[model samples]
Target: MLISMKIVIISSLFPPNSYGGAEQIACAEAEKLAREGNKVIVLTLKFDKGYACSTSDAKNLQIIEVSHKNIFNYYNIGKKSICLRFIWHIIDTFNFRLANDIAEILKRESPDIVTCHNIKGLSLLTPLKIKKLKIKNYAVVHDVSFYTPSGLIEWGKEKSWEHMGVLTRIYRFFTRRLMSYPEKIFFPSRWLLDFYYKNGFFINQEKLYKPNELGFVCENKSVDSGGKVANNFLYVGKIEHHKGILLLLDAFERLKPTNVTLDIIGNGVLMSEVKKHAQTNPNIKIHGQISREKLPEFYRNAKAVIVPSVVYENAPNVVYEALSCGVPVIVARIGGACEPIIEGKNGYIFNPGDVDDLVEKMKKYL
Candidate 1:
């Protein structure tokens, strides 16, 4: 059966103004829908007024950039203290200007389905507005941002700390209870939905797991070690403590596999630390930030991609990209990192934050 639908895709960040995995998935899904004969409109935040609050129809997609300046960026918050960053996180969610812009669009478009991806930069009230308009609303939980300010559940902390802060508690109430009230909600992986459920989310609402759709696909993917390289382990994401980079470094240093090498890509606050380690270690290569066009080459030329995230990641796009190139993954046993990997088949999973466990998993390729 052929169906034509009006779909309003809402995300806080879009491509060319990337935030992370959420933007990549949102943009790709929206474009895919537009190509499938649906009338699609993408609502995303635009910090620069020069972009304008106008519509552009290209490749069968309509993009509406809502004009709003984020307080964190306006103050240049890189390398700032945790307290200051938390303040920014609070302000980012309770945005009223972006809300008005989206609400007005909803009124005019009156789309059949209001599909929301990430609403951190915009406002969580987006789905509420959609419901108010009596439209079928769907939301995708690509992150734990609704529960925690940084979307990270710190490792080794007691669960008590999760609801310790008043701001976090309030945010959780809205995100966990109110936001989950959408007509339907999607999780990219079972681990993600389970994580939310274990934390008391999805109260009296519909939820399901839908694997993230990748932007590209490689043909003739094989289970054999048929990638371009045999002994190269790759890590593509932020270099941060909560991401388990420090633990990975320590594990790699202590393990010291004689025949294999490790490659680190992307940027973050821990650049200096990674650079220092790269200076001391010859096997560890720091590529900084590589262009998107050059990413596949890296994935193809690697034995396996390492996702050592200690936080509760939803479904990392790196894993999808790696799989698309027929490269296996060695993932941490937390969050969605372990969801895609099939032990002894496609990839291996090790206890998160456990150096010895990671070393054992890495040795399989080494």
Candidate 2:
């Protein structure tokens, strides 16, 4: 008399659609659970790019793609004032019709447990509908901002004051009230849990579960260590100030290594500034948005992958990616990024914005 649970994963993003930290975690966890003999299916939004639509079963996991149009896709929005963000939230949360469609799917499929990742893009309304349908549900909070509005404001990008404003506050207040409908809340890091606790989001800490590292089994690939004499460092994330791209560049400039080069492999609002900086310094190279498939190649060839984020990240997949590829990581000692690093064992860590410390750390590896 063992009970087998049918789990439905509701995430805003999924593999081959978009590659974000939360999406990766959802993908990995679903695969793991499926491998463990539990029926796992993913309900995710399909981007307009129309890359691949066919679904294939592997490792006992199934992925269902619900097509989505990019109307209020705030994933691209860099930063905005509190007022503008509040308005965006209203439009994003209410105007979208995806929730109704998702609710229909939930009614049809009737999964025993529903696990949600990022619902901002998909609209929280859908989950509410699932609750009305009396479905057992759970949510994984990948970032602190989901619980509190003012989480990442200090990143020097467009701020979402509106989401942190009066309207958002009202919405959050109600949302917190409805949060108890879910049986459990999963957090990738303790920092996120503590942030929510201090902000008065969850009363009982028992609801929070760590689930630290996602299941990431690296596929065996040929490694090529031989190349040109130029020593290289790698950065693999959005080109934003909060990611500490500017800080990394500033530190690289200060270090002034004649033979070392830094390769930036993502795109964002700071692209123009990063491009301008790269123009002045031939040592810095911006490769703008590389596909997820191509990321392993970058990690395989680099001296070390750098994750210099200024904000409190829940858990960065890049750190795991670097480790999986057998490449070392140099990260900032803030948030969940420090969870994997052993402070010189497998990787190195530096103060969040300390250019001098970063320079010194870079010198050790180079």
lDDT of 2 by residue, 314-334 (tens): 788888888887777889888
Specify the highest-TM-score model's number. Answer: 1
Report the lDDT tens digits of candidate 1 across residue range 1-366: 244988989887777676588878887788778878888888877645354333324355788877555554421344677787777666666666667678889899888888888877676666666777788988898877776766778656636565467767887776765585488889999987887888888867788889987734554242324644456788999888877888888888987876767889998889899889989888898998887778876777788888888877778888888888888888888777678888998889998888999988888887
RMSD of each: 3.4, 4.1
Off-target runs (Cα >4 Å) in candidate 2 are 1-5, 35-38, 46-71, 74-84, 91-98, 148-151, 155-168, 211-224, 227-230
Top of the candidates by lDDT? 1
Give Cα-based local distance difference scores for all models: 0.76, 0.73
Clashes of each: 0, 5
TM-score of every model? Answer: 0.88, 0.82
